[model samples]
Target: METKSIVLLFIMTAFLTACAGNSKKTVQMAAKPIMKKHHSVVSQYPMSLPPPVVESRMRTVEDVVNNFGPYATGQLKPYFRKAGVAYPPREVTFIALKQEKKLEVWARDGGEFRFIRDYDVKAASGVTGPKLWQGDKQVPEGVYRIVGLNPNSNYHLSMKLNYPNEFDWFHAQREGRFDPGSDIFIHGNSVSAGCLAMGDEAIEELFVLTAQVGEENVKVIIAPRDPRLLPLDPEGYGLPSWTPELYRMIAAEMEGFSDAVKVSNNRPFYPASSPLR
Candidate 1:
């Protein structure tokens, strides 16, 4: 009976030892660090220096020449000659007039931009106003820059615009807004929801020109009207209270390209002379 009791006690002790070992293992697991998911904007979406996607799709001068060789040589070269500007200008400016339905291309001259060509904005949704929020359908009226170039675009070749610039962001944040829609572009196809639709031929010229000049050196100015001729009437347009200040800022920038229209007076260099087929 004593021997049997000893064997039973040994079995119980072994069971408790096994349980203790499992408990210790459980405690170790609980002590292990729990990885918390990062939520900060910078952490979640780390800024990539020399963004890989942009670099991969970046167009070369040869690419531009190959795609738009004829137009660049036959048409654009003569236009630049007449404007007294060099071909493949060091810098380029795009002025988009919503009311006039015009998109003017300009090249850097001695001190200012000289007009190169003006293409009709085949179609653009919304009236004369700044794009307030996503789905507002308003063509944004502000200074923007070319942020991307898509050679293989659904709407033919397209040049993406940097909308919601610093000013746009500041106002949006102040107004407690988020998700101010994007993907604005100057593209081919004579149809638009809230973008500049400059037809196939026009977009090809623009795309080639932008590719040659380098997207970083291209500046885009979008406005309700020719600010130089007809000044912005905030009240007349029934714009927000803060718009007058914004208009003033845009007007100041527009003043720098006042002489751009002179290229229109130079008839010999007009696009009609050597139209892009």
Candidate 2:
């Protein structure tokens, strides 16, 4: 029994538990089918694109924008106003802390980034670490860009990410994992295979905001946890050996947002009396 237990423990530790590879294919999110089922919400937050899957047959970016643009834009006005920025800032940054299950939205117009709002991740798969291959179910942890937008997504609307970026490819090539999965996204809905599910309300705001600001100007930085608040201890998790280097890169970019809510929203990410600082 003792020996069996030890073997099982080793297997668990060796298992690469994470899922960043969505779409299950050769890159484009379009290649994946739009999920038939929906998990629309009703509360202070409602669904972005409601079901019967009204937009199921609907295609084209313009069609999506026309359908949901006004609603999304209207809803976002107050947030941008509260953040003291224009309707569409010059740029935006999305920071995801996987362990915290939180996503922070920051905006700027030729100045420092100011917190706009934060959202619950709703659903994401896998453990902490960079997405090494397809179906690992791990969320990729690194600096990335909004490569494209998917108006018709399996999990409602979604914004595509450049997961296998230069860093991802370089590492994969070295490691010799040729098919390092693709079609990663931050989409709506409450189910995730290897994508960040931001739910309906959040995705509408994000999707609309991304379109308004233009995809090129949007940057995404995903990390395991907020290093500023509490650094990650590699010893505690079943992660790869190269994780430290990847974390350092994430930390450097995150430095600008350490005082996250201060510049605009005034919602401090950390409590004033907290000892973690």
Candidate 3:
């Protein structure tokens, strides 16, 4: 009886030991895939780092402009003083009106922007509408920003706009549109297919100003017309259903800079000697 009891106890202890070992193995096996998945995810999308500072040795758009004709920094000094802003403004906003053919430049002063100057758009294709497709010959009417600075451009010095932004992409995706087209620029030359042609002289100043202020700090607002002065009437024209809503969205953004225009009345603030021709 004693031998049988000891044998039963021994069997129970062996069984419990086996069960514990199996449990540990199972846990390790389960954790292997989880650890692998974590590693895979980390490898797939590594953390993004901030952009590196511009190297002094690398030739910049500002350096190129300085070597050209008039120095943009020198030309912008008087205008900056009149607007009560620092030289080579920290932030710059460009309001491009399609119908009016005007490009208003505003510089940041303290918390608000100060009206700088207006440049005439030498030429722009399409009448008055947002660009929807390739070869549409339409100048897009939306909020944009300077994304690229092309010193070696066919149309002289040019600054590229990030067209088809997140909003544009969303609309295109919703409509199942594939080719929205791209390469929109505020370039030089009087001839343009679907770009804002500000002429050679105008682009030089703009290009330099953009480079100096940093492209990330520049904002470009393209509108069908000056929404502040003229009301947008999509009903008046045969247009897409989304046109009116788009106009209202643009008007809302324009409202933020309304005070800048009011203070300067959309007139060139530079002195007579330093006129924006």
Candidate 4:
């Protein structure tokens, strides 16, 4: 009888040990998954760079370009016409000059074809080309930003461009001259001092498109001439006329821009006159 009691006591002690081990192991196993999820949440929303509060906000031109196609069915329908060449509709496009006195919109994704939209422009006092000097009453050129929409303007509607960029200010300082009256725009029918003018309907459409995409995301490219007319090769244009020192400085700036934006173009290497096929 004593031997039987000893065996039964051993079994009970062993069972209790097993239960204790399992309880510790189960707690550790459950904690691992919880800890993993906690780490993931922390890594995704670090304090240094918090995630955007609103995911739908448009922060870049690329975002706007990629999304503009889906918004075309509304008032923007008129801007859509059958494409002339074999090209997919692009998201990021530029409308510069057209034979129909219109703007040509091209897409980054659309391979090669450009869409043409008729627009009326008020050229500076004399020409249809890019404005070079201040007070030439000419539109300032460079990569610009369209920031606001003016509904109560003398014109039907107007969108603002952030012009007179850093380069312009530098040039002005170097030349010891300041060009007065520099508020240029892509606006409505009240003839401009030197802004691009579109009809009321066109401006309204542009306003809607730009507003949907967010003003800060739009970039305006004002060139001496449309780049489509220039050559595409990077190695062939005769080098720019600059002293060794100036060339190095310019090349450095170009390199920095390329690195920051990951865009490489041959146009900078050649004169704007070279024909590109």
The TM-score, computed over Cα atoms with residue i paired to residue i, of candidate 4 is 0.47
How would you encode candidate 1's per-residue C-alpha lDDT over 42-94 as one tens digit per residue? 46566663323534665554675696867756667888888789978999989
- Evaluated with lDDT, which candidate comes out highest? 3
- The list of candidate 1 runs beyond 4 A from truth reads 1-65, 259-277
As a TM-score, model 3 comes out at 0.71
| Model 2 Cα lDDT, one tens digit per residue, 1-277 | 9999999988776663422244244345553443222222343235763434444466767777787899988887888788788878999999987876789888888778877778988887877678988888778889999989888788889999998999899989888999888989999998877789999988988998899899999999998777777676555356767778888889899999855354444443543222210
Residue 252 C-alpha lDDT in model 3:
88
List runs of model 4 lying over 4 Å from the truth: 1-73, 78-93, 98-101, 106-124, 128-134, 230-277
Write model 4 residue lDDT over 1-277, tens digit each, in one string: 9999999999999999999999999999999999999888788998677666775542343443344435533545444444343222334333433112334343333344234343444432323333446566655545567766665556766777766666556655676557634667787673656676776666665765666556654556544333343322223233222223332333332231121111222222234443311
Query: Which ranges in model 2 have alpha carbons more than 4 Å from their true place?
Result: 1-57, 235-237, 260-277
Residue 241 in candidate 3 has what lDDT? Answer: 69
Off by over 4 Å in 3: 1-62, 259-277
Of the candidates numbered 3 and 4, which has the greater lDDT value?
Answer: 3
> Would you list the clashing residue pairs of candidate 1?
none
| Model 2, residue 233: C-alpha shift (Å) | 2.9
Alpha-carbon shift of residue 167 in model 1 (angstroms): 0.7
Give the range of the ten consecutive residues with the poorest summed lDDT in model 1: 268-277
Top TM-score model: 2
Clashing pairs in 2: 18-126, 18-136, 18-137, 18-138, 19-137, 19-138, 19-194, 20-138, 35-154
